[model samples]
Target: MILFLGTKSGKEETKLLAGISCPYCKQTNTLSAITSPTYFHLFWISLFKVSTNHFVECSHCKRAYYKNEFTPEMRQALGID
Candidate 1:
């Protein structure tokens, strides 16, 4: 008998937080929030979610920032407490 099991990680864009100037690119309306989920898989099929993480990105510069790194305004924009 043989068994196949492993973990898979993926990222998805959750929603558009707001139109704001990016600190890195200094561009407006380019920052957005993304959700990254890590999960367990069996036979290439997703079984259960292991963990999830949130991030902010600048569409202009393609820079990514973790949720905890978000500023007060940014957090509020995303409706995150």
Candidate 2:
């Protein structure tokens, strides 16, 4: 996941999670923070007394984007290179 940490210079820290996109299907996939649900409860409880976290699964291609990285088209449109 992309951690947004503010810097002393008043700039945002951009942490990108790199991965390969499927050529034919053009699907962007990412790794999950946790896979199994067996330790899910314990993992969550370690931090907060009550917390809520969501793991998203793409319905179309079944890919995960924890950081929600942008696509080439999006980058070009936003004038980001």
Best by TM-score: 1
lDDT tens digits by residue: candidate 2, 1-81: 654332121212232223534333565543222222222223224322232222333434656433245455334333445
Clashes of 2: 0
**CA lDDT, every model vs. true structure:** 0.81, 0.35
Query: For candidate 2, what is the TM-score?
Result: 0.21
Name the lDDT of candidate 1.
Answer: 0.81
Q: Name the best candidate (by lDDT).
A: 1
**Can you give the lDDT of residue 33 in candidate 1?**
83
Candidate 2's C-alpha runs over 4 A off are 1-49, 67-81
